[model samples]
Target chain A: MSVAQISRNEAQAPVEQREALPLRIVRRLANSRELTLFVLVVALALAMTIVYPHNFPTGPNMRAVLLNLAPVGILVCGMMLLMIAGTFDLSVGSTLALSGVWAGVVSGWWGWPAEAALLIGVVVGAVAGLINGLIVTRIGINALIATLGTLTIYRSLTYVTAGTGVTPISDSFAEYGRAADPVLRIQSPFWAMLVLVLIGGWLIARTRFFRQFYFVGGNPRAAQLSGIRVDRLILIGFVIMGALAGIAGVLGAARLNSAVVNAGVGIELKVITATVLGGASLKGGEGTVLGGILGVLFIALIENAMIINAVGVFWQGLVVGLVLLFAVSLDRFKTAGRA
Target chain B: MGSMLKSTLIALGMTALASAVTAPARAQESSFGPADAKETYYWISNKANLPLFVQYDYVGMKKIAEELGVKATGGRQVAVVGGWDPSLTESVKKCIEQGVPTVVDDGDLPASGRLAYIGTNWTQVGVAQAKKMMEKVPNGGKLAMMSIINAGNMREAVAGFKAYIEANGGGKYNIVSNEDDGGDAQKAAQVTAAILAANPDIAGIAGFDSESGAGIVTALREAGKNPGDIKVTAMEQTPDFFKTAKEGWVDGIVVQNRELFIYYAVKILHDYNHNGLKSAGLAAADGGRPVPDTLDTGVLLVTKDNVDKVTAALGVK
Candidate 1:
């Protein structure tokens, strides 16, 4: 481990020295898709603002968009990391449901403190992820199949936990969803998501242990020869993904003031779509925190625009489907260019 | 090996016993009311999770059954036939072919030998809801109507509402947009949210079903829009709908008595199965079995003023 760290540090020093203006620009483009998506998002926002000048550009409407993105944005960070690590976790949606139900059952039904319920949710999520990681890595099952199985099982568990009704949260717990201050008028979830994005970005870029995540994902055999514990890294990644999902779940429950058994259904698809759209390759080892956030923002902007434009609801699925196809096509073009 | 065989035999026996216990008792009663024989009524619905036609309706019918000293039970079963029209017609045909003596349906089914249709008058309900909305917004702005499916009873309901809006209200009422949510609340909510965003000036919205209604209400609340800002109406008397009404997010709901439908349907089936259609005196009109060609089980208009009355009637409080 010490030898691998020294070698990686030495590799980083040379790359830093070789960095020039053109190289920096290229690196910036490569590392963050936000520039492109930010422009697109701004254009869409402007269009909406023009169409519905009275309502669309207002502070409250902007706050609504940000608030709506909070949970998915947070979950996408973990999803991007997992995708970068060369694995997928479709169980996050189910994990979200289970975590929310667990929290609600504990706090609302069993009279547990909201804080304790949240803790339990995160721990349980991590445990579930650990099991998934072990099965995928040790038993050599495909991550997709393993996570898919867990998805069904976990969703069924949510049904069993909540029965059939929405489990209402206490008023005190619901207050967590209120705005932190008047300046933003955005809910706590949005602020928490920003903090998560920063931490995630730092972890991916600055941490020595975390740098090994890319190598392990890029090539497990090569990473193992470099003395990185690939299996353990994968396990840790899954656990982090699960914990983030749990936090998102708890936040969702708080925001809705109820833990609906169906709260997070199909969320995994959205998270993965955002991660992939952000330039994360399914083949592994390439994605950035900033890029993932931009991807989420872009998708969210589309949703906001659809709503603002009064596009019929049936067209939403069609629009999302088309966007996903475009993103995949662009990814192929980028990969071909690199090759 | 002998012990294993004995255990296997016992397990098989237990399995058979369990199935027997859970299976519907054969319909062999002297009359529609309970006799020495135990009769079971099997009712099938389009969706298992239906809170209204399946749950509330069954509960109401069960009460009537108990009053008449009969045993009643319902299960979450989908029609082998799909779609509102075919499903309704097929359900009736299946019931007749399978010798299901009496079948009560929520939608209009092909009348062969079935007992009755104890469901909402979809056309009337839609017309009534539309009339109320027209009264509120006399100039009739854009109205959005949501349905679970674009077929059968829902199609009829929307048609009825549109007819009334067009004829009586003139150019005042116009259905600007319609959406089918596949009867899923989350999908319905998403659809409603999108619709609300697109047409903020929409004067009224109506959800043709319970889940859609709840979804529309949730979407409205999420958007921070007041219920009165856009007149919203829904069908069924669910706790969520009741709360939405109380909170002033929903303007009104058309309530159907599902219980009465089920109770009478079961009774008619029992009578037919026991005495045959003719012997039961169901063949002719007035003097025969009291199977009205179209029994108006009746509907109640639920609003803020009368919500408490409806809730109390449904024992929701």
Candidate 2:
């Protein structure tokens, strides 16, 4: 009986082969873009280490790089999610400025508790995002146009709140900006970033609602046919992005001990660059939390190395732009190969 | 006419004598009546922030006008020709175009056609600041000059200081850097931090503008460096800046009286309206003013010793 069964299975092996090959190919292609980006990040890190053996490989230097990139990392996480959901939030930088200014004004100028002020800032950001979502979805405006409008409005709001200057935060709030303790010697923002990354990773990987996000971005018509709440998901994604930007704003304000009206000027470009470099397609539906963190770290390391090498400030922007172009090109090549 | 003519001649002589005496008396009594003076003058400024000329300095001149019972009216517009360079070239151009007879400038006005240039002698200001810095840092050390914006005046100030230092025989002092702070306090602070990190031995820093000074003070405090460690000097006085100075975060500041600029500018404008540039040579009592071309409105050195007094005088508690 066992021999007869084995011969029967051998006869059906070609049928199974016909079923499995295409699926395997598709799966490999799906992961190829992210895998290539990951390799590039590792290669860049290795190159940095080789160039600055004494500082790049050291624990202190690595910690500094991580700490500096924490805010950028948090922002990129949200930016990637938004991109995955097929929307752009150019107003994140302005939102960050507004949140920071409000937080500083509420707590510093008005002497409110830090916790309350932070809550209000986050809420304000969420509300702003909601308005952006409504403008994009309900009002049938393009995400880019809606966000650009909010960007100017929010920036102007920041100026008004900050009275066109820097508003200093309280000492206690500033303490939150410093490194946690000697044993860790890592800033509070670093810890917050790690937690945020973990939570974002879980949301993206484990939840069914989160899975719906990919479908919405991948094919909105198909997702709508499949009974996914596409509009709601997009709105929620924007809300999360806004909230994260708010958190970043507060962290930045705390670190600087002052909320400058121009606090997050040009930050949107950096965050978007990191997201795109992390393999989050501008076309939508592809990104990873780990990839975003690595992207930010790569940029931070380059900046740190440039500073350590005593490069002129004027050249910094050009160098960063070139690096961004290179990363985007590599991403495109990898994506093309996968397709 | 001899006998009867003798009588007639005596009468004619008497009549002629009477007519001559009356004519002389009438000439003595009939002088020309007093003429009415012109009451309006045209004044112009490069921009509202032309500082001593149009803003704070104008207040003092307005008071002088009121005291002298002169009617003055003019408009302050953004710099028409020059943005930062307050050269008389633009003012001269404006004067000629507007048919302005007399002109008073904050020294930025071109000397051409202007009745007077009544602002600080910038070169002298630079020399004075440099001299003060030298006095503060006798042994001489590295100094950084922070400009609000890298404008012409600041460049001139730096040039003046550099010339003075060079002329006096360059000693232990050198200008380590000249950073543009963009008049933003945060940026100013960041730039100062970078400068300090790059040149830790900077013994003195001078701010060419208000915000830069505040930024330098903040950076110094954060770096755990004392005011004495780096002799800091800046232009103008704000409440916060004075507080910092009181706490010894600043060595001294060069305070210019805006009143002087206003008073002189208006007076020069009046002189230009009535007497033109030539009449500006007349004494103040004689309704004549000095068209020094470059006026030293005056500067006060505010140090720890005089910080309180100056603050009190400025009413900045």
Candidate 3:
């Protein structure tokens, strides 16, 4: 079966025989990766709430957790799109730093209007993405190698552009990130990520043009034979990925009001981890924007729990890695159930 | 043919006389100038990208290089020894054996037989921070500290801070939280916000890492806490720190002599090369102006009262 069909089959349960409710629930969880991640995220959040009632469930703590995960959450939308198209960008972390620095230089150093800085920063990120797309499609370089090369190149450019960093990048520019709704009190980055996830989810699941990425990722050669313009689709996927990374980068810098050169260092791993857990296969064509976002939520909760528990930071990676492996291992049960 | 030979001989004679004439002046130039303009010296550190190293240490090295007429570059250079890893001590020893001049900074590695030790006395920095906190919160309440707790220097500083509080402050101070900010300002801010959430009664915060001060102040502003709501003593003397100090968020800053570390390390290296001290070997104990065992570049306490004066002197603003 094609990779696109693989994800679809999860929803169609076999009418073979009646089973115990517990077994049915287990089978249901195994079948849907989104359900599994959602359940897991809910469970983790509930458990933390129960255990550390005062600390974990408080308004300030929740706000901090939501705000902290915003960047990763925003990046996951683009990553899910790329992974659905059978490729990914490792340069996102560096892209974030580079974009933030440009924004800082424009608004903070050059004394441009905040809107101009925001526009320039996003444009820089899209241009960077455009370069990645051209290189991968035209040069036919592997996405891994192409993006990995750009990762260091972009980071080096960031340092060359602003050695230490641009701090206190105008209060007007900072307001874009710092502004929060009175109801939830969550910052702009979180709100931005939410809007992207909702829109991206609808477009990928419903729209004809976005659905073409599934065909391209599932089987590129077959997709091209069917007049899919596989390379064009993949290139578009990368550009979208880059633009999303740019938005994330700009928001992060604005929120902090400081464009740190090392902002989002090693964040690519976290983002990729969340994408994989969200149900994106390395071979592609098997994930949802919702799944990717749930993965981000799960990891954020895990980190928040660790922080609340006062666990050493060293244990965090171990916990997250083990959880990822455990989540992926659940796929084996789904395969067995299909048999 | 004989006339041509005479002309060559006369040219050779003039060149020889000129070299003889300039030799003493050349020797005198080499003697006075500490380093050769053609030779390049390097300022090496593990985290060269760190703001402390980038903004101050590297600048200091470059300034000294210009003065000494030598080119200086910040490179990976030999092995940089920091952290709590015991293996690093052996690595330093091995590098020392390979005739590499290693200098310890921020933290001491005396067993490694380094040429000289420069930078803040870590333990003293902690004591100074603690003392500053004591000054602000005389009847001390619960205190929280932020740093990279795993680092060797930070551990010493924390221990010293704790020891001083125990010995000096008659049971008034209690360390409620000592968390690691991981040296990233953003992470520091997040951690500080969480810390504030967890410890609503947190009386004061002592920030050991350079990033901690900004993080603490940012967290306070985000939480809508006014200046001096909770006493804060932080490290480093960055421009952000200066701004925060002016706003009265930070009670006192335990400022390390960052530039002085580079200044003294390069001086030690220069003298080691040009002052005929190369033969002094690993310990440099052969007695020809033996390398200073340790140069505690020391710390400066910058409070709101003297922040303007300090910033003016450092030309930070």
What C-alpha RMSD separates each model from the true structure? 10.0, 22.0, 12.0
Question: Which residue pairs in candidate 1 have backbone atoms (N, alpha carbon, C) closer than 3 angstroms, thus clashing?
Answer: A310-B198, B102-B269, B140-B172
Candidate 1 backbone clash number: 3
Reference-based lDDT, residue B12, model 2? 61
Docking class of 3: incorrect
Instruction: Please provide, for model 3 over A187-298, each residue's C-alpha lDDT reduced to its tens digit, 9 standing for 90 to 100.
Output: 8888999999999999999999999989888998888999998888888888888788888888988988988777878889989999999989999888999999999988
DockQ by candidate, in order: 0.13, 0.02, 0.13
Question: TM-score of chain B, per candidate?
Answer: 0.77, 0.71, 0.80
Q: Number of clashes in model 3?
A: 0
Q: For model 3 chain A, where is the 10-residue window of minimal lDDT?
A: A9-18
Q: Could you tell me every candidate's TM-score relative to the true structure? A: 0.75, 0.63, 0.86
lDDT of each: 0.70, 0.66, 0.79
lDDT by residue (tens digit), candidate 2, A1-339: 699999999999988757477666644543554565556567767886777566456554555556657778889888888888887899998888778777777778779898877787777677667767766665567999989988987775664445433335777776666536566566687888999999998888788888787888798899999899888888888888889988888887776666656666667888988888776778788777777777777777666655445565557668889988876666655566567
Poorest lDDT segment (10 consecutive residues) of candidate 2 chain B? B24-33
Q: Please, what are the lDDT tens digits per residue for candidate 3 over residues B219-289? A: 78777789999999998735666767778899888878777766677677677666665334533434344
Across the candidates, what are chain A's individual TM-scores?
0.87, 0.86, 0.93
Clashing pairs in 2: B1-B5, B46-B79, B57-B258, B57-B262, B86-B108, B87-B108, B88-B109, B88-B110, B102-B272, B282-B288
